[model samples]
Structures are given as C-alpha cells and as structure tokens.
Target: MNIVCIAWGSLLWKPGPLKLASGWHPGGPLLPLEFARDSDDSEELALVLCPGAPLIPTYWAYVDAPDLDAARAMLAAREKIHPGHPEWIGSFPAVDGAAVQPEIAAWLRARGFDAVVWTALPPKIAGTEGRMPSPAEAVDFLAGLEGETREAARYYVRRTPAHIDTRYRRLIEARLGWRPLHEAAVTRMA
Candidate 1:
C-alpha cells in the first residue's frame, strides 16, 4: 500500500558517515529524526530530483503513494524529462515479495547504467533470498545503520545531457575516470 521512488545519485551534500546520514527533501535536507517528529511518519515520503554530478548517490524517496499506478506514471514522466538526473533510477512499487537485485541490475544495464552505488549489500536477510535489494528494499534488507562509503556515494550523474553514443559518459569519463566526487566539489574538497 506504500509507494516509493527508488533512485541513485550523488546528493547535493555528502552523506558522510552512517551515523551522520541525514534525510533530505525539497524544502531542505532533514535528518531521520525529523521524520519521526510525528507518529505516522511512515505515511509520508520524499522524491529526490537532482541532476548531473560526477557521482550520483543511490537513494530512495518514500512518498505516500495511495495509487501505485499513478505514482509510477508520475515518476516515468520525471525520468523522461531528466533520465540522466541521478535520482531517475526508477520508481518502485513495493509489494509482497523477496528482494530482487538482479532485476535492478538488469534494469540499469538496459538503461545503460554500468554501475549502482550503495553503502553495502549484506550476504543475507529475512524474506530475501540473499538477493540484492534496490534502494527501495535497502532499509528492509539491512538490520542496522551501515555507513555509506564515499566510494558508494558516487554514481553516474550526467554532467550534461547524454547521447546515444554515450558522448556524455565518455567526456566526463575522460575528465574524471570514475569516483563519487563531483568535478566542482572535488576541487572544493581539495
């Protein structure tokens, strides 16, 4: 009965350490505690729409989707508008089933995404047959807070629009092979 947008991207700000990871929203970034401000926090969800960073962080936005179909359509529209937007991974409609990592991998591959960034994937979990969970299944896949590594934070943020030949990927790849840090942010960090 819940709807979520599962995306991977380099967030505007770094997630830093596991204990330091903060929840984000359109209003501004927020911490998980902020969501717990009320008892029915689970009913609410967020949708991240950032674009073109060296590495796009893989994250999930849990929005209240009373109609899963409608939510999926909305997300599809967003993807078409900005497929390269790091968070454009995909909209996931959570239902009763085990996690499917291969499905996600196939989806990325089909979409030309060579890699998916994540804090880490455990070897096992309940209701899951050791299959990898997409960002949507992460919270359900893991037992506790696992620090999101800088390596894991980075993802394919189309520094600019992309082409069929992957001119964008290659151009950026030439400038900076592959890492989580953004071109500009890297200099700032340096």
Candidate 2:
C-alpha cells in the first residue's frame, strides 16, 4: 500500500505523520524535497494533498491504498493531526537548485500551494526508502527557537509553521544509522 503524508501549517516542523509512517522522511517542503537546484530533472509525483484546516473539516485519500477505509484510518491518527486531500498531482518544472542554502527559496518557489507539501518524490523503487527530512535538523532548530517569541500571523490564520531547516535528521541517523546528507553552503539567491 502506497500512502502519502503531508505537513502544511505548524506541523511542518516535522515531516507529517504519514511521512513518518511511510518509513521515511519528506526531506522538507515540496520544492526543496523534490526539485533540488542540483537535481536538473523533474517528474509528476503523486502528491498527498491535505485539503482542509489543520484543526477540522479535513479529508484524505490515496491512489494505491487498499481501500478508502484504510486511507481514512491512516489520516485519522491522533498523533498525526490533520490529513486530507484535493492535491494537485501533475507535471512540475524542476531544476537543479543551488547546492547551497537553497531549499528555503526552493520551497518558496513551489509555493502557491493549497495544502502542505509533504512527500513530493515517493520512493516507488525497491530498496530505496521514502524521502524523509533530517530530524536532527528540526530538533536543533527548535532548540534555537526554544525561547524565541513569534510575531503575529500576517494572514487570517492565527499561527503558521516555520523553520523545518534541520528537522528529520535524527531519525535518519538513528533508524538507518546513515550519516546525514551534507548540505551545501549557500547564500540567499536574490
């Protein structure tokens, strides 16, 4: 069964529960996860579109789930928060983004999103695990923000998610004992 997980608002701090359940990390937001400035290629991936608020009035589905019931159960997790869909899966233009501090802008590049961008590149091939982000990174970042106070939300939404910069690294290191990917140093592209 192929399941897709996504994280939009505050949950973007982690790569969503479904992403965790998928046995991999979602690397980051959609653009950074799938279209690396260094990727130089792109494809139409089955996006797990969470259509609705993180609190209520949400729904979800999968293309390869055994049935709707299973998909519903998967989304109905107390731990995972909101999960729903109406995700737009289609051809997206991808390019090898800068090999530097590039994912943030890349994520912004993929913006105008209706839902959260969790799993962009699902691991359809064998042996390869689903794309996950660095949990260590998230932890470190959160540690940094441990005492910081956030400003008021610009949008009508009260709170919005920020900084998944160093997330999901710990899980990758812990579960697989795999060293984290070496993030290329980067200057913000203007």
Per-candidate Cα lDDT values, in order, are: 0.29, 0.26
User: Quick one: best TM-score, which candidate?
Assistant: 1
Off by over 4 Å in 2: 10-20, 27-68, 77-190
Which 10 consecutive positions of candidate 1 have the poorest summed lDDT? 31-40
Which candidate gets the maximum lDDT versus the true structure? 1
Go through the candidates in order and give the clash count of each. 11, 27
- TM-score list, all predictions: 0.27, 0.21
Angstrom error of the Cα, residue 138, model 1: value is: 31
